[model samples]
Target: MTTTDMLTGALAAAARGWHVFPLLPSTKRPARPNHRERDCTGTDPRCRAGHTGWDARATTDQTRIRRAWSSNNPSYGIGIACGPSGLVVVDLDTHKPGTEIPEPWNRFGIRTGEDVLDHLAGARGGTITPTYTVRTPSGGTHLYYTAPEGVRYGNTAGTIGWLVDTRAHGGYVVAPPTTIGSSSYVVTDDRPAAPLPLFLLDLLKPQRHTTSAAAPKRFDARTDRVPAYVASAIKGEVAKVTSAGAKQHNHRLLCAAIALGQLVAGGVLDERTAYDALTDAARVLMARGCDCTPIEVDRTIRSGFHIGSRNPRTPGTTRDNSRKAA
Candidate 1:
């Protein structure tokens, strides 16, 4: 596409209330540079006080959009920041060479990412609703779905199903008319973005111990409702809460309670046991001499637990890492 087309596309996206940014000319990468704090010399105006990444610099204000896209590089392509736009764009990717579809999906003859998503939707007793869809230059599809109210999802790679990825918070997608060489990403479906399906949102729900606890501990309720694996998760989460930094103490405690509370809802842990574990863990914060009182800590924990109990996540739903990158 030409400069005029790129600029117009950006303005159009901004008009739709989606924050837009300029991608590098003839490329999918962002045109704006992301400065790092340790590498900062404090000379540049944007990073004078601290670092500012491309995501933060994204804007929808007409004046700023015009200035940014028209400045040194008018040929820049359009990019939509999915988070600010309240979007969770599911990337149905085409399988590249040297890749193979894993089992379950493989047995069903699932070839591309679209097929994987379709299969997943079917398994969940639903269908892919009509929404704004963009066809990538590589024969893949970008299904734009509005994120749930007050919920934030992050970028996932092959987690939902084989070849299926999602871009939400901390991610961006090249918009239509953004060309890669001679091929351009085109909007195949012009419908309004649909609300992300509830089943889909549960699949994207994030766990607090992405670093500390790698996976959800699995167990068979037939033999034992609460196994030693669940015990480990509890210990890890409690450790995170008690050892959290001064500002993070309350938040961490709440998150831990919520996580354990999910297990309680799923019948994997006793509610009383989970509460007692977390309450004892919160005592560590008090011992560390934080301003927090017993009542406030108890309230935060109870609130978080109740919130989590509302959305029960069964243990071992997040299995099959081997199938990732399929």
Candidate 2:
């Protein structure tokens, strides 16, 4: 298959549940610390003082990762993850043909799997280097060095940053700017690199951790009981309420609920309790007044549904009365 065709196939596979991130551009986010101090117990100095830190053993999620430019709070940023170890952080910003390797520990290159190995061999005085490759959602490949034992590779943000040290870590991600052709492969000289064995591939496939506290059940958005935007907001909000605290967690959801609730409060589901709950929530958020879009949020008092308990308005079904009331 052609490169675009291969990408489409990968995206189709991703849609079936493999998370995919289109290499799209995002606005520059107001810069935050490359790292945050956290208080896991909620009683530590950082936790009480509102500091943040990432736990090495903490589960890494594709949807909950965030980067410098994400709008979603504590956005689950995109990266190439392998068998419990995070490879390189993918830079979605630059799309040029050549690869951009990080400095001091300059390891990544434009070469393919086969060629990268040779380059590393020359650099390391002909020492044999082992390599592993992963197929990206865009049908590109991520090359890694199987570091010798006792070597360590990690960044300050734990699961977030793309920084890799050559002697310290056994593996590194192929930087984003690097592009591999349909027939070209990569080579590395760090160690002896080879194709992944089936046993390792089986382990590398993404699987939700059984130990993850079962995600709280969420109301179905596909049922068309809620307006599309409101349903989207609810799905987004549910993930918000339960999320472990991160940079972008609360403000957007708070704003979304306010906007949607105000829009749909006076219609068929109009009740003082639901209306008051939403209004109060909005007011609290507005008090803090972080920047967010003014979208309406409506919720059913009894059922956890956004619009109402039963079959409610679908995307195109906003009732005239509801609009008038809004």
Candidate 3:
């Protein structure tokens, strides 16, 4: 499409209260540089350079939108910032590599966008509610929904099965009428973006509390001793493993290993102690009918420990912790 057509589509999107920004021609990346040679590239928005990113440049203002598109690159594609636009787009991808398909489609039924929609519809009593949908340049579909009030949903990659992604807060999606290669993103359903269904909303909700098992704790060790928080976190992981189902047993064990590795790297737990503790923890699961082999447990712990040792918990500390010992 021509530059005028692209700008017109952008302006039209702006009219729909979607905060629009200019993308690099035929690409999903922003048109502006995120960091200049001399400017601060920190998280501080006030110190950012001019139009450094899509989130900063994204706006609904007609004048600003026009200026952004009418510049040297009029052929630039349009991008809509999800949060500002009050949108949560369910990106049903079709381009995932064959090796990455979680389930064997030949054995189990192939999951498609239609199947997902059907499942949602079935949960809501057989009526698949209509909303604004976009057909991407690829065979994938972008299902747009009005974001839940007051809650900011962030972008999630591969969180919802394989071949599915979400574009929400801090995320931007290419607007319709933008062509990439030979294909174009076109509006399939021209209706307004509908409110996200309750069932889907529940799935999208941020998991806060410890439901089935205790949540994994992030490693933060600034003091010489392993903090109470770190100890408690390890305990929680152990508890999760002991109580985890057969399906979750391996994952919970891996998480515990990683945590123990972090503690070892931070000088909280010695290497031998970490290994013994992890082995004992795994034993608890094995006693409770968990099917994880001893070899898998040892391998998981060793791999995690190696990684944590390389990137120690202490900030700015070298890979070698001998200096601290000295």
Candidate 4:
């Protein structure tokens, strides 16, 4: 399609109140450089060099949208910023040519986007509610939903499992009619974006400890060793969360929660202690450029703590030392 056609689609999305931005011509990547070193803070001469910090660059103003598209690369693709657009897109990635199934999906026996969708549907008591679906240029799928109010969700990869990623706050997705090479993103389902389902919401919510009074007391026998163990566990989970990449924000938070939860279950730490330690670990990852928020860390820990409390670990049993912790 011509640049005019692509711009028209972008304007349509903007008309619907979705924030739009121009992507690099015919590419899914943003038209900006996101590196902190190259990041532009405001409208300076350097800022005009490239579109940096696209989350801030996304706009709904028709004049800005037109200017972006009418630039030298008028054929630029359309990118819809998720949070500003009130969108939460579930991106089910397909296996790229010559690449094996990603580790997360293979571990879960998921082979395709449809498989993940089916699993979600089954978990929700069958019959997944249909929403506006987009067929991506690379044979993947984008399932769009209206994000929940008062809850800001950022992009996440592998949090929902392998081959599944989310585009939310601080993220963007290629809009329909965008093309890369011979492939193009097309609207498969013409339905409007639907509200996120409850099951998905539960999965997405941050975990946090609510009751300090009910927190488990530290065990006397292993009191000295408890601090060391807790430190070790937190460090280990932090490493995992960090190594997983920014897209795995939720996944990383969940991993930290489970790790700290294990420590709480082992009586090495109380719920309050575990919550603080987990939060610190999450912060460490965030400082290193992970997309984690304090709220997300709290919620993840709370959720994991419940599970750990229910299945307290037996005393004297040690976790696998073979596994490297940080």
Candidate 5:
């Protein structure tokens, strides 16, 4: 088999364990449904019913707020991808207003079963620790982390993720996809100071919801036509991973590859051959040591709409609850 074929085969093999789905080539049809055109409702109880874009989470205008996390995929033994808007919690054990801790904020206490890691670094007046922060397409921020094992993913309750009693509930087994510090998640290459040292005091002060940013004029999902800024950011990430020889799980690489594939299908690719490019990129990322279970890869690519740039997540958005799946 060709190198691409060999890599694809290997990725397929690894996916069987992790639950990753392959990025299938779309039929070249003139009227394919836009992945962005569907409502998240009905998929799960926590899905914001009737909401199409990011602003559906809003009740009023000035109420917009956003949350950040200490780190991504904080598992110790098993590695998890902590997918797009990983911080947002969708399930909250059916909590109500005034009871809801805001989805993302509650995940620490709920899913991972610990207080959120403060991202602030060096505030202790000692040596600083490296920090990375990245903005998601939903206008939310994802703080990746390296945490102990027992944290996991679940599809119980018809949601993609929910905190199930790992010992008793007997649902999906979730684990970190790689080692902490080595594979937590990528924030910005800017390496902002870890925010944990400063915010670690209250443990719940920082809010997880943010108002959606106004849609940019002339937005395009085409890989080539992607907003210059977004394109630059993606390129920068690619460069950072490549230059540092960063390794991730197959799930992460697959999510990224599928994202590129969808973008290509949407006419965003500079090159017309998005399927081949995606497969090739997956191979390259895998070659670089990015690792993930096939299950994780499959799960991520099938759920690529979450990677969209226009649909910003809101603080207290229904999806932010830990009761919801990741």
Candidate 6:
């Protein structure tokens, strides 16, 4: 994407009062490096000034966005800080070729993140309240809603369901028209964001501590969404495995396996696809001088993946922690 294209999209969001920042060129990772407090060398350029993270540094000023992403600088992608934007975005996602929705969701034939949200909304005796929305490149959606005044909701991971997530306080989202490879996030609905409905707002609140998993306070059985963002991650991780040094060969492959496992649990990628990809990468790495054999690699992947499935995850997406699933 061109700097001009990014600038225009950033301006559009900022004009709507959504604070924006620079993501890395073609990535969701922030362009603004997060300075570590422990390494605050006070004099180092990266840490010389008081540390200002992406969320804190995000702005609504058109000039700031333009200057940061102009021709003189990298043609950075756009990130909208959800909290500052006063938005609570329901991130509905699709699944990868090799993943399946978990437990209860799968039992109900629920596949996408959108389906989960819709099912819950129906259970709550309500319909989805449409607002400003962004559609991610992988067929997922970002349903933007106005946050309630004075409530700071943080990011969540599968707390809503198998593939659904939310982005709020302490989180950011890749804004529309930000390209990654050939695809880009684009605005599907440019209308003003609707105020978050009470039902959903309540879901984002502190859920009561319970002995057992509790059904969300106001959910029904009408969910209709899914999630899928593993395309680049798989390719990247596999590439890493194939290029890893001897000291990190097995470790890198294991890590990649575990990461893919988390996505499998999150319904973002299928188990078989994740396994085969890792196995193939491992075999290639082995052929390239690493001593690891196919059997050993398979076992390593399985072990790491088992550990990861317990905790579902999202990658480079706006993750919201709504109430935990029952």
TM per candidate comes to 0.61, 0.23, 0.56, 0.57, 0.20, 0.61
Q: Lowest-scoring 10 consecutive residues by lDDT in candidate 1?
A: 207-216
Off by over 4 Å in 5: 1-227, 240-247, 250-279, 288-299, 307-326
For 1-326, candidate 6 gives per-residue lDDT tens digits of: 78898898889889999999998887889887644656565664545567667887899887778798788887889999999899888899887778755788778978888888877754542335546788998889999988868778898878977678899998888988899888999888776786664347547786521111222122111222223246666776788777888788878877777666666555455455566677777766655667766657756776555555555676654422321211
What is candidate 4's lDDT per residue for 65-120, written digit by digit as tens? Answer: 88877745658899999998999999998766687886655787778876876566
Clashing residue pairs in candidate 3, if any? Answer: none
109 Cα displacement, candidate 1 (Å): 1.0
Ordered from best to worst TM-score, the candidate numbers read 1, 6, 4, 3, 2, 5
Arranged by lDDT with the best first, the candidates are: 1, 6, 4, 3, 2, 5
Tens-digit lDDT track of model 1 for 1-326: 77778878889889878999888877888876644657777677777777776787889999888887674566888889998999999999887878766898768877899888766654543335557889998899999988868887899999999889999999999998888899999989786676675347547884321111122232223325358778777777888887899798877887776677666545556555566567667766666677776667656765565555544656665422221211
Predictions: Cα RMSD each: 15.6, 23.7, 18.7, 16.9, 24.4, 21.6
lDDT of 5 by residue, 46-154 (tens): 3535433222221111111111011221111221222211211211122333654646647545422222222111121111112333333222333322211343322
Q: Considering lDDT, which of the candidate structures 3 and 6 is the better prediction for this target?
A: 6
How close to the true structure is residue 159 of candidate 4, measured as C-alpha lDDT? 76
Candidate 4 wrong stretches, greater than 4 Å:
32-52, 97-109, 124-127, 206-326
Per-residue C-alpha lDDT of model 3 across residues 131-228, encoded as one tens digit per residue = 68899987888988888679889988866545668899899899889988888899998877766643356567854211122232333333353466
Give candidate 6's total backbone clashes: 33
Show where candidate 2 strays beyond 4 Å. Answer: 1-50, 54-77, 80-117, 122-131, 135-141, 145-149, 154-326
